[model samples]
Target chain A: MHEEPLVRWDWIGRNWPNIQVLLEDHVVMSLVPIVVGLLVALPLGLACVRWRWLYQPTVGVMNVVYSLPSLAVFIVLIPVTGLATRTTVMIPLTFYAMAVLIPAVVDGLTAVPDHVRQSAVAMGFTPLRRLLRVELPIAVPVVLAGLRVAAVSSISLVSVGALVGRGGLGYLFIDGWQRQFYTPIIVGIVLVVLLAAVADMLLVLAQRLLTPWSRARGSA
Target chain B: MVAGEGVGVNWLIDFFGDPANWSGPDGIPVRLLEHLQFSALSLLLAVLIALPLGLWIGHTGKGALFAVLSANAARALPTLGLLVLIVLLMGVGTDIPVLIPLVALAVPPILVNTYEGIRGVDPELRDAAYGMGLRGGQVLGRVLVPVALPLILLGLRIAAIQVVSTATVAAYVGLGGLGRFIIDGLATKDFPRTIGGAVLVALLALAVQLGFTFIQRLVVSPGVSERQAVR
Candidate 1:
């Protein structure tokens, strides 16, 4: 007679610390890229909108970035960045977020009523002051929405970083699947889902802070 | 952004060379062509199966909860898990990944748009249709679907771009597509070729978005632009 074991409660319990380590690594990797992507894409989107002609090409880039699967991007980056750290994991993620951010920001800017822009100039506001007080305030909602997409997209993307050997919750999913360990996989999925929800909520809070008017419109 | 660097350059050469020995049973471009076939087949199957089913499910309003559950599950479920499960059923290679993710990829937007559109249908129209002696099917077809058509196409907009982007992941199982170029680049530590592949995939996505936007205008119920007046 032979006995087989399926549940690895004991092993999983022992591995909690290791999983947390992976989670920390994953967070650092994912966030750095997102912040950097924002620093780059926001300005690009703003300038592109003002210039007008750049809109087609700039947005054209985002659409392309949006389409490519994260895994494909990871594979492409790995050859140069190699198997470890942010270079391999974060670079493509930032690129992916740009697609979401650029369009949203542009859309937000466009969403501003044309009359508002006209009135600001009529009031004799300087161009810099006009954008700072008028154009940008109106555009905040759109920018936040784009940033929301970036948040969600980045959360999903961090999972792919697992494939590149940069740890996060995706580490749990990938390693568990590699060994056919369901418990860890389940844990990883739960954590990733929670992480996504939490990130989304934080973005919601940020949105509320940035746009007081949205609070009245938003039911939640 | 290290746009140009020694490691990146060296990796690019290695990647291009890696596939140098990757000839097929036939001739040159055989491997590349096979990959493209797999990608195209998957995309077509997804559109065929998912689009109609989504349209139906969207109309039914009965199966929405199930559709949402399935879509979310599909979004989060690892492709690796499906790959392994399929392997247990039938030895693994290309076909299933192509088929499985297509349905998974297409379902969310199709279902979302379908439900959102139908549910969002003006109550007045439904009342009018009801008074006209229209049965349920006729009401749905004539009024609901027409009204919902733009949003549904918007969902298609999301789906079209997504499906094209994800189809490349088919390379994990050795299924062919531009992903092969990326994978080949990675295995040999080649950056330029990898970048080249990423560039191509991104370009394809952009091309798909532009093409689909045009299609949306043509196929969407005429005066879709006018509907923005509602928003």
Candidate 2:
């Protein structure tokens, strides 16, 4: 049998359009979860901080949810969400994002010094205004750090959805493996890793821009 | 449709209720064992490689930048992609291809946590240990390792859980494990087997989590453990 090369540039050139679609699907699937999770986590994290008692139990439950295999979660959701659907994949990814983001949100909020809060109060700032204008801005660096992890992991994990027929770039892995071809598999891995790197870099840039004071403090 | 869904749920229960599914080469027990074997072996390999490197970087503080950067890079590599890529590259006759990705997946958490744990130790404690005339190895073993034990254990627990969960991918490439139920069932459209497999995987992951929590309580010093809890 004539051996296939590790990569076929010709195959990629021909399949560029399909690959682009998968790459776009991968990006959307990965990004939506982080956005949705941050929205959900912000409220939940605030509630956890407010209640104090709720914090430990919320974290405990989230940890358990995080440990469940992504594949299993996708399969289990098949009944509710149907198979080969983007929703089935995105739901589990959202939970995983929340698992990371909630802690980031909470830790970011908690790290705001007591004196900072007191000054906000002394300045006649409403609780909502204080949180919006003061606490959340301070929490940007920590929250961005969490966002980095969540984004990277979510991008990587969206590939597992390929098992259920919606894995975005992950579909390439299954396709390549089933045919014993290397192009799709290699393409998938590279794109996923690159996507993660790009997303992480963007978040780091956002942190630097949003929290310039943090870099000064960090260096000091 | 509702009635059909009810039947599906019942079949899932019956899948577990059947004694015939409990034994033999194709049974749950055999699959469970394969899953654990894959997880355990991969974890062992990961720890052997990561632990020493983490310790060296942590203790000496050299290459700390390199370690953190590489670990983060590893984190971003999709496990499914790595698994398939290795299988394609190695031609998938042995279990080595599967083990490579599993170990790769497990390494970053263990390495980062171990390094952070050691580096997080107070300088005062290190100085006190050195002041007692303890050699470098002795200070690391006696002072640093004990203090860093909780985080190290936490890393192992995270790695173990991840390995167990991801081990399901083994069945994708014709290896036997609990994931067999998932992949086979999904292929055959057997909802019972699929859900049952997912339940088992989730349960196993939870057991691993609880097992680590128990071990942490048993082994971590009361002072260190309590301090961690407070944090």
Every model's DockQ = 0.24, 0.69
The Cα error of candidate 2 at residue B189, in Å, is: 1.7
Please provide, for model 2 over B65-148, each residue's C-alpha lDDT reduced to its tens digit, 9 standing for 90 to 100.
977887788778877878878876876788887888889888888998899999999999999999999999999888898899
- The residue pairs found clashing in candidate 1 are B11-B189, B11-B190, B11-B191, B12-B190, B12-B191, B35-B176, B35-B177
Candidate number achieving the greatest DockQ relative to the actual structure: 2
Give the top-scoring candidate (lDDT). 2
Clashes (N, CA, C under 3 Å) per candidate: 7, 1
Candidate 1 docks at the CAPRI level of: acceptable
DockQ of 1: 0.24
Evaluate residue B181 in candidate 2 and report its C-alpha lDDT on the 0 to 100 scale: 92
Task: Give the TM-score of each candidate.
Answer: 0.75, 0.96
Worst 10 residues of 2 chain B by lDDT: B222-231
CAPRI tier of model 2: medium
Candidate 1 Cα misplacement greater than 4 A, ranges: A1-7, A114-137, A216-220, B1-22, B25-98, B114-154, B157-167, B173-231
